[model samples]
Target: MASVNRFIQFNNETINTKMLHQMEMLAGALADAPYLKVTTRQLIEFRPSESSVSVSVFWRHRPKQIERNGYLSDIYLLGAGYWRHFSIRAWTKFKKASTELPNLKEQLLLCAEEFRLIEKISKERPGTADAFSVRESIYRDYHRDRYKQNKQKGFLADAFLNAAFLQLRGEEVPGSDGFKPLFFLWSGIFDAKSTRDCAIVVENMLPRLEYMLEEDMVHSYYTFGEAVENIPPFRYHEGIESEQRDQEEEIETIEEWFQSWHRETEISEAPAMEFELERGDSSYAEGGREEEGTGEIQQTAKGDSRGDHQEDNDAADRQTEKAAKQASGKFGSANNQVVYTEKRIQVQQDQRGNIEDWRRKQAPYVRALLRELKKRMTQRRQDVRHNLNAGRLSRNLLPLVIEERPKPFYRKTAPSKELDAVFCLLIDGSASMIDKLDETKQAVLLFHDVLRGLNVPHDIVMFYEDAYEASDAAQPNYFEWMHKLEDGNRDHAQEIVSMEAHEDNRDGFAIRWMTDRVNKRTEKHRFMLVFSDGEPSAYNYAENGVIDTANAVSEAKKQGIEVLHLFLSSEPTTEEQAAFYRMMYGNKSVSADSLEHFVEQTLRLLKRTLHLVIQSG
Candidate 1:
């Protein structure tokens, strides 16, 4: 018997990397796509809320933890295979729209979208179909168990979701008396007997599932409003007192008034579902849409098992509308007022002394680097005789070639390469960086000095968000440029040394800001390097900081900019810490254990950067 001894310690636990890698291979095969190109940020672990391993835009990779806890082969592929279809732009739009909907509705729509995408992607990628089938079954079983536990909450939502899931798997669902009456009464249209029927109804309700981001303005209330309008009214006994009947009548009158008040202002028709079965098309449809008005009752039900028709749905609609408005209003102003202003600061006298001292200490390494770079830049020209061939007479040496054998002629041209490059160094100036400020300054000094020696045009910017002053009206994001791209010298060396800790760090915004500057540069090579002691941390950004930063990095890559992260820290001892850094930086991140090792790590990074640039060039 072989021993399962391969392990890596993370957060004080031993994890089996071998097993985790095996799972990755299995996932890649099951996905029928190329291996997801494992990045440090990809963490596979057990989430009780998730039946199988899944990757959400919210997923942060925890490699060590996943290595320790082996996962079921099939369940792990559920998420891995699904994530294969994720695209940055498409995902951002999907996420934003999902946030606008109710929690239950959002989950339902997300599941439907996933099923649709997986089904489509699986057709060309062999094993994906099997994996998708397994995922659907697991999802159905999990939801069924959850519904069983909460049976008293009513199964209308569950049934709607279940039917779609089953239909997605090409299975039929038996008719249910309990949910049939409620669904028909609520929709005033479809009485779904099979899973396919329910799927058609759900797709019609959320037609913007595939193109949510493309919509000009997301009207979240329309779908729920239509659903509410058909909900059967609750009834009272025929022998009820006159006073009670009057009270009910008055409530109904108010409900009618509220609905009418908002109806004219709200969007009435949801954009129709545009189904296309082509593989590369911008559609999520795997099949044709049901004909309009088919199986629809068209008449609203007046009574149901809950007794007299009640105006409860009206209240629900009102609440949904209010919540949507509040959410929209909060970000509207902030989005409108996104302003970026840059300022230059002179190096302080005290900081100049420190900069001079560091410059002297780094003189030898700087000289060596400068000499190598200059040597590479210099080109020597060689002359060669032309118009001569081994089998023919040479024009210039025709007499010698005629007497002996002919020599081939060659031509030489001096090809000089100027290192056309632009560099943007983004420094994290958050409160958490207070302890690491001195080390950060030293590293920035080294970076500035090295580039200065090579005459490379670069910018150094420190970014932070003022949390206390942040609001819907204005978000106070600061970018203090120690060295502008055009600064071009060690003149602002003091400013680099003067960098201090600020409030909070919004990494994604900062990266994007720097990326824009680099994008405008004419340099053939561009690099945006981030220096941060921790993951993105800011007011209201804790939950999404990692994902947002990852997306920002991805965006930069798409624009032909090389984005890298220098994870500045004393030491990262936990898997969570490692995962967080990887999540933000992907594989293009480096770490320094302490201030003492900063120089060594920086040197290694510089060497690697130069090699990549030269190789690619």
Candidate 2:
């Protein structure tokens, strides 16, 4: 087997390469890295580039004992236009990976002793078959907003990070087979290393950059098959339907009405499915008008217990159900078997025409949809109690009366029920972390598991508003739905992320979309969570809206909804950081000394904010 070697090379024109300082930093800082990958490996390569003088950036973040936290592949895709030179720094592992020259081995030990910490010293980063996956979430100094900073700065950081990330990998991310690189780029910024000056700036900085910086911050979410344009288009002085938009999608500019018709269809390689056939367990609460007056409705199995869960059989059942209902309506037949109901006709007219055809076309999608609907119903139940206490809802709901038989009438006093806590997950479909959707998915999985474990009632609603690729939404019984989609395969979600959840997605739009509907919807013990990098633009960012969000919190507080906010920073360059604190928490939020200790930083913040809200409730 070939020895897994490492090395570094510099282009011929290496000038002010910060080489010595870089090597110095890598050596001493190995143990203090952001990730553990760096601390274990060394470097090897061909002739060292005088232009790009290098010292292996190695690290050793071995825990006293190595234990694995669930492994999920994270990929970062750079948005367009944004770019910078040497501004992006490396975590110790990347620094070591960059300097892979075998000849420099002896020199490395001698040249940088300050960096030579507890890890003795090694001639080469030794490994035979595999050291680390090529497509790991190589840590670059992430000081951007979603990770660390705010919108504008985050965009700048994203451009610089993308350039740096691509340069390190030395190529485009792989797709068909192995792994891919996920750049933590963004919406407002879009230019990477695009110009001659851009490359000159970068080339002038690094002695041995492996991947070439292609361009600067041009909005990647918009270009699709073309060049990434500038973000907001509003700021670029262009509307969503500017001249550059494909004429067909030009009609998508209408903010409130972008069609996600292909939402399920686009989730996979398969075609569309009939809604009824796919509506596995009609879990929607059979209450109110939607489910009224059916003489003791019999329950169908949420799913068949038999292991051979055939998509075809599910399809047949749906068809048979509809037909039987339709025939009963038209021919006054018995309530059994297929004959074509109003629902059946509609299902047949859909892309799947025949119930069987639809199932064949979209088996997995149908199941996922059914799962999402069930979650929504579960969440709504939690709100009923909270709304009544707040006086926003009719507290005098006369007891569940069996028509006039129970004869239950509204009493003089208000009645209340123990409202279930409604969990509303506002999924950020922004383009910042496009490739590393596994992180997002992992986040959803983690939060859902934690809540469900506690038997907390909640709902998952996906949000995205990227005009170019369009947008989509969903609410699902997360545990079952995510597991089904993953098929227990957790690694590749980053690669298959939906296009709509890219750089162009807007947070303001997502928040408003959820809130507009939420205003009318009822959920007591309500909690609405916003998960995003906080990159909403001037047009999208509404003070009134944030005020509206605050009011929602106030309303939730009144109803004891227990509103909470969890801001996940993707970069470290927040403008004031306090701004998010003041807005999300009451003003005066930035007591956070530094978030370098990410786990502590976020966890503490979430606990503090949540505690405050609960106390307010």
Candidate 3:
């Protein structure tokens, strides 16, 4: 059981996780990058390399709707505004031009460009004006307070930047009559349309402003082109002038930008060993037919119309192949570049004896659950027919048969239908499971035994990441198969007992990998049961891991595969833990406190899920 204070802390963490997930979805949708993640850091910026956006951590304390929307607006500005319109080349050029300027001046130039992007967003998305308005209101108040503090500390450079911010937003800066002329001169930034235009405006006003503000700002508050230089050069299609082509180019560039960011991270690390996984063929081509008179016009004119058609088909095929490769790359990242090592647990004589001993100890509970499941399945297959023309004759129906039709037979049973379902049981082998491993294995044994008795094809595997050897380039994950679908009714009690705690677990990646396998099954009903102790934890995958796992669960559900989570804990589950589980598994999650509870909950989930499968079938 958790203490009251600990419960409160868990509650807060759950809330933060939910909030982070919501923000991630919002940013990903706006940026049109579904894999994009959102997190809170010290500063607000878009990290294309990580495929993530960060909001300032300060916003976590402000719970008001205005503040919330203001931060949401910040996401929009970065995800949509900067991600879509702001060119990396232009940003790089601006950085080069500002290298020799004072820190204050450089910050002002960055601020100008930010406002220009914000203005563009307002014009394009009028509905977002209210959020941006809230943002402006918050920044004005923040700068005003900072201005007073900087002035009192005799930091003229910092105070001037604050004053300039206020003046740019049309707010008056007090006791700065001498600097009013410079503020007016810098106010032209509002009229600037492009980043270059903003830079020119800043450059023209910097000479006189530099003379007045001799001391450079003591602190740097602005971030311009934080990692833009790391991005690769944009590849533009020559002589592409159509609006649709331009839009396509922009979308492609944004995807490339994200890829480049990941590439940069990969380059910073040592070369990793490559692992391969089977992927499905592409279902559809991404883009439409190329323009008729593009570069291929001369070649097409040299050939007959039939040859031209064949050439077009060839081009489409190439495009589809390229799209498939791109999709495979994306899927690899989703797996966190894990090199999966599938091990078949080999039990020694002593281990086999121990496995049999444990199975004997758990035999009673397994039998009880198995009996209950069999009884329910029998009842589901039982049929009661009220009236029939043939089969068993009913004496009570004879009277009615004389006055009406001659229906005198009834049936008491129907043919039993075999279940058309498949099951996948994924166990978390993280170090935190050391204490609960015994109970978890017992519950898993029950699950396997009952499913095997019912003749259902199921798989059981334990997954974990090797934390000590994990790196940015490669994370080695192991999938220890206790029981495989091909194993049929073979009992693998020894393999189940062989399970031990490993280093860490990447829940999202593991879930997705299992989901892919389950998806390939031909069963009409599919189910994935995930067993874990707590939230996901892996290298560079704490908060994002939760969101990613939640997304994975949702994706599995969308694919018509039922996903249920069993949270195994040594102590009683608090309301906080339940809420946290709900975020990842929706309503299909159960937390077990004791050994008996673990087995009981697993039995109940299986019963309920199988009942649905029977009913639907």
Between candidates 2 and 3, the one scoring higher on TM-score is: 3
* lDDT for each candidate structure: 0.52, 0.30, 0.72
Top-down TM-score ranking: 3, 1, 2
lDDT per residue as tens, model 3, 1-617? 11212445434544355556677778878877776767776667666766677877656557578657867787877777777666555555655764334676668877786788788888888888888888888888888999999999989889988888888787888988878778777888878877667777777877877677667889776754246545544444677666645553232334457766655545433222121111111222223234412222111122333212433543443343221111123333445456556656544345766657667976786677667766766776685675677888787865574766766677766435567899999999999888887788778888888888788889899988899997766677777778877566777777788888988888888888888788888999999999988888887776667777887888788899999999887788888778888988898999887656887798888888987876665
Clashing pairs in 3: none
lDDT per residue (tens digit) for residues 1-617 in model 2: 00001123231111111222233234223323211111111221111010011122222232311111001110001100011111112111223443323222212221121112101111122221021232122333222222233234444323444433433434342221111222221110123322222223323233322232222333221111111121122222255656645433221211101112212222321211233335432433343243434333333444535344435443544444432221111111010111211111111123223323423433453344335434444444343333222334344455334334332232222223222344556655555545434445445544444344334455455543333432222111000011121111222122112213433333333443344434454544455565554534222222222333333344344544344444555445354443543454343233323233222333343344333323333
- Largest lDDT belongs to which candidate? 3
lDDT of 2 at 602: 31
Per-model root-mean-square deviation over C-alphas: 21.7, 25.9, 12.0
Alpha carbon deviation, residue 126, candidate 1 (Å): 14
The alpha-carbon deviation from the true structure for residue 453 of candidate 3, after best TM-score superposition, in angstroms, is 2.2
For residues 27-96, what per-residue lDDT tens digits would candidate 1 score against the true structure? 5455442212221222322221111133321112345333223243233334443333333233233335
Off by over 4 Å in 2: 1-419, 469-500, 506-509, 512-524, 538-560, 573-575, 584-617
**TM, every model:** 0.52, 0.27, 0.75
Q: Report the Cα lDDT for candidate 3.
A: 0.72
